[model samples]
Target: MKLKGSMWSCIGLATLLMAGCDKSPPISTAEEQPSAPKKQVAFQPDWVPKALGSGNFEVCLSNEAEENGVKDLILPVGMMFDSWGHMTGSLRDSKAFDGEGTSGFGKSDQYALALTARVHLTSDRPCAITQAQAVTHQGFRYRHETVPASLHYNFSAGGLYLNKKGGITNDMKGPAGDAAQIGLLSGTPISDVGDVYRATEDL
Candidate 1:
């Protein structure tokens, strides 16, 4: 009887030890763990002509804050009616402003697109800055082309000349091939001309 009692006691202890070993550490509850909030990236402007549909847009802060700056500029400015707009750079693919709708706008119309870039906005909501918008109920078709752009003040020259102060824009990379030397400037989310894109649908 004494031996049996001792055996039972040992078995109980072993069972308890095994049970404890089998048990898992307390599992974390969802409440115990929290997740970080995501950044805001959605905002559509009414200015994008209804015809071309919508565009792939990211928060300006996304591109603006980048080390190299915007790779491609989604321009808010558009042609007259049904202006889908351009996404790359330079407004005029051609040097001849007389293409059709190019002149009247200006001769400098051939300058870099970044110099005259604009973005879209519903209202000047606290979220984003508003520029220009489409006034013409009818929008126009537009095209885009990437061109070499030199944007900066002459490190030594400064202005148009070395002594002058104001200057144009440029990418971090040195200008190569054919490029336009344009000043750095921004346009309204909406443009007066929508800065009528420098191309025409007539041809």
Candidate 2:
């Protein structure tokens, strides 16, 4: 699919979630990137090249479970802090980040929760994320596997929703949406998914 805006393919989530200020160069999409043969795909998370989840690499594997199967990508982010280093509670409460969401109504959210996403790959079944897309509160589609020069790639919530009638507050948190075309692979497919991805590069 043809996409606009900054795009990061293969392996770049760790850099996207990094806590620094240096700007990264703009990332372009793999519109012309050749897809790997299904037989030739390699499914490797960050540990092989470096220590697991070290530096700026995120291993994209989640625990297969009896519950919480609504999403394949889930993580608990630390509460946001403002410029003065004051705690920003949750996205909705932080008026500094007021925006609209799926609801299309402008209301401050009462609660927000960044669920814990442990930093290890529990299941290595390289998934073919058949259909995935993410956007911002103001409705900007993004494909960021790594952090952009803007410093954050907080996507408007796709799969997950807020607990409140006025929840989630329309702030950005990344989540590669549905694995619509899912199938198990012994190795990684040239991952064509996320808000994410690089052109089949090392993590």
Candidate 3:
């Protein structure tokens, strides 16, 4: 995907070049950089990763059902949020698939849920992501894994949303709590997902 305002990449590369240059005149130890103080960026709620229900669906059911039969899929449609309050990730993932067997054949049975649109994320904080594509091992049941999700800001709203890509917002209307939902299936329990965001903030 093409990113807007990618000149930052050039600037970063230039910085690396200057740092690595050997032809530049050697400087006295005192004249050299003492090392820059680590920057501590202030957090903002807007930049926190989030999911806003777009009231759309993005799933397609084919003619296939399990022994117990199956129901048409119901997927969440929403936008991903960055610390800049912009959408950051794609909504499609493995969790979107849920159904039993062989029900999509009939005209009445086939259904489709598609990503309608996404909001743009605007932020200066470096986004942290853990792509499923990054998984080193595959097809192992009960294998323990903890992937980075989102950047935290408030350290209160549980810092920021993990999985900067933003998760599915299954419940548009709330009997569930929170302004946004995190994690897959949109149907994941609010408390659990929220807590994960919170705990990761400490790191």
Candidate 4:
């Protein structure tokens, strides 16, 4: 009986020792590494134009803000349209500016379907701060030799370059092609030129 009790005691001690050995140590996590900083791009005004319909379009005015100080001063002054409404075609100079519809507007009236260049907006509503829109014209002729373009009605919407300081430079990569011209006039957004037209019609 004494031998048997001693044997059981020894077995219990062995079992407890085995159980302790089977237990796992607590897991620990490593410290996290710090993240790198992000870089910023500059805003330089680069105007581009795109057509929506036969006589409708949208323009995008991009101002790339560079980290470097070298920049360009783009002007806003352009052809001043008069009471005669939106002129058409390659007709550069029209007849004597009429009184009512007799006022005049001027720009490099290329033979393309739409005005060549775009300008930036002045207002804030409808998200038109650094935005651009299409310029309209009538009576201009087009040919297959160049890209197709839409027409501009009397009430067509467009962008106006206000506070322009840069010379006319065609930076097509920014928005549209280089065929368009940048104006030298300074003005505001003519919201009444018609309602905002969608950038893309086909969805």
What is each predicted model's overall lDDT from 0 to 1? 0.24, 0.23, 0.23, 0.25
Q: Candidate 4, 39: how far from true, in Å?
A: 63
For all candidates, the clash counts are 25, 13, 26, 42
lDDT of 4 by residue, 83-140 (tens): 2223232111122111123122332332112222433332121112222233233321
Please, what is the TM-score per model?
0.17, 0.18, 0.24, 0.17
Candidate 3 local lDDT, 1-203, one digit each (tens): 11111333576788899888856786587667777653444433343234433322111111221111323222222222211111222222212222221111122221111122322211221112211111111111111122123322111010112233433222244311122222212111111112112111111
Model 2 poorest 10 in a row by lDDT: 180-189
Q: List, residue by residue over 1-203, the lDDT tens digit for candidate 1.
A: 01212343688899999888888776787678576643322223332222211222111212121232323333222211111112222211111112222211223322222222244322121123332222211112123232211111010000111011222211222211011112111121222222322432222
Alpha-carbon shift of residue 70 in model 3 (angstroms): 36
RMSD (Cα, Å) for all candidates, in order, is: 26.8, 19.5, 19.3, 30.1
Can you give the lDDT of residue 63 in candidate 4?
Answer: 25
Question: Model 1: residues >4 Å from true position, as ranges?
Answer: 1-45, 48-107, 110-127, 130-164, 172-203
Best candidate per TM-score, number? Answer: 3
lDDT of 2 by residue, 45-161 (tens): 331222233222122322222123423433333211111111112211111121222112222221111222232222342222222311112221212332221221112222232
